[model samples]
Target: MKQEVNELIDPSKFRDRIDIKGIEKSLLVDMLRKMVLIRKAEEKLSEHVESGKIKCPCHLGIGQEAIGVAVSLVMRKSDRAFGAHRSHSHFLALNENTYSLFAEVLGKYDGCSHGMGGSMHIVDNDNGFKGSVPIVGATIPIATGAGLAAKMDKAGDISISYFGDGACEEGVLHESLNMASIMNLPVLYVCENNLFASHLHIDLRQPSNSTSRFAKAHHINYNTVDGNDVVGMYKLLKSEVESMRSSNTPYYLEAFTYRWKGHVGHRDDIDVGVKRGAQLDSWKKRDPIKRLADSLIYEGVLTESEYQYLNHEIQNKINSDWEKAELASFPENEFLITQVYS
Candidate 1:
């Protein structure tokens, strides 16, 4: 049965499924725009890194844009969201400020964290993205606390914690889940199970590939969905958010996704002793952005020309922003001492 389950959750076997009849045209277009924006922004960052312009470490989520967009669509600007290392998509999907993100990644003072935090330590409180910490499982408890604060206020606002399958191994995640379940806090755990924890595959790390089973252990309501399907993710998250809002209870969603790039660089890192190149190629065929555009075009909701136009516009914007970041000034030396304590 474990073998069967592993076979079923295989990333390469996932397919793109979008039902145009069940979605709105405008929302579909917006989702496509956001996904494309994220993909292009990451691609721009990849070029900067290859040219030695970006010194900071970057964990690009090249193929995992849909999950962030779906969840962001269900969240309000006041609701809090958090992310892990591979979280540029999470920040952009909610904030939609590529300039600030590019500045942040480039270590400029105008960055979201004012150049102190690089790609991993991103913060935009006004946008409700509390922040993203690089330390795995570090933000789980923080998000849980935010949910508790929301509960105390008796407000409908909730907190979303986005972590990878690797973070699931951390003891704090289980503790946070159990506490959230027992407290009935309005927290949502989005596990982007990309089947890889940095270099090792999920099969080598865990007994089972499914992370939602842990939710069962804590008796938390859970749902597993194909992370590549933006529409499906949006619908599922919408319903879950609604239930959490009404009942003020925690929910868990396990999104099966695959990162196109390697763990922490621009290259695919195929030579890193992992024979996942072919599998990565297979996952590209399940590209979420293209799938949505094709479905919309097939249903007369969007035109081929319009799709091309959107891509062109987004690419130009990302290029412009990258150039701006490239020319931006770094933080002043003395300012670094302000945020530190001895």
Candidate 2:
């Protein structure tokens, strides 16, 4: 069974899949647009980093955009979502404010965090993105707390906690799962299992590739899907989130995905003594953005020209936002004293 699961997650086997059925045309296009926006925006960040224009470290989720876009379909502004270091997709999918993200990473006052938090510390309370921290497994308990609050309020809102495979190793994650399960907290734990935690592969760290076993141990309702499949992810999350909202139950979704760039920069982490050139190439072939577009085209929901036009539009928007962020002023030195806490 483990061997079969491994085969199912193998990127090479799923590269040619462009299946879309019983899905709305508008949703397909919208998801495709968001995925493209995320990809192009992250690519631009790579360019800025390579040119030394940005000093802050950015963990780009270039290939994991589909997970955020899909999950955002079922989430409301009242529901809270938290993410980890590779969370650009998470914020954009919720707020659609690439300009603010750009400004924040550039340390401009026009940023989402008022130039205080960098890429890893994105917080948009109005958009229901409570926050994203860099520490592994840090947001698990925080999201559980949010779930508790939601339960207390008796509101049909849930909390989402996005983390990576590495976070599964943290003791807090397990504790958070057990607590949420026992309390029947309305929380959705989405683990983006990219098979690598920093430089090490999952084979070296965990006994099995899938992280759902932890969820099973906690007796939480869980489902594992291809993070690259936006439509599939949307279907699964939408159902589970709705169920959780009604029943105040916890849901665990383990998404199998891969990061295109390095663990922490524009370039592939190859220079840091990791050699995944072939694997990266294989994953690129399974590009989630391309897969969705192909599916839409194949299903007669979108034309090639329409898709190109959409890409052009999203790229232009990203360019304009990036330019604005570049021209934005840095926060004043005096403001730092006011923002500091004793």
Q: List the residue pairs that clash in candidate 2.
A: none
* Model 2 C-alpha lDDT per residue in residues 1-342, reported as the tens digit of each score: 452157546878667656677778888888888889889989989999998988888999998998999888899999999999999999999877899999999999999998888888999999889999999999999999999999998979999999999999999999999999999999999999888888888888888889999999899989888889998889878888889999999999999989988898888985553446658888888888888888788777989998889989989999999999999999999988988876
Instruction: Give each model a TM-score.
Output: 0.96, 0.96
- Give residue 90's error in model 2 in angstroms: 0.3
Across residues 60-129, which tens digit of lDDT does each residue of candidate 1 receive?
9998999999999999988999898999999999867999999998899888998889898998999889
Q: Report how far residue 249 has shifted in candidate 2, in Å.
A: 0.6
Model 1 gets an lDDT of 0.88
* Model 2 regions more than 4 Å off: 1-4, 271-275
Candidate lDDT values, in order? 0.88, 0.88
- Name the weakest run of 10 consecutive residues (lDDT summed) in model 2: 1-10
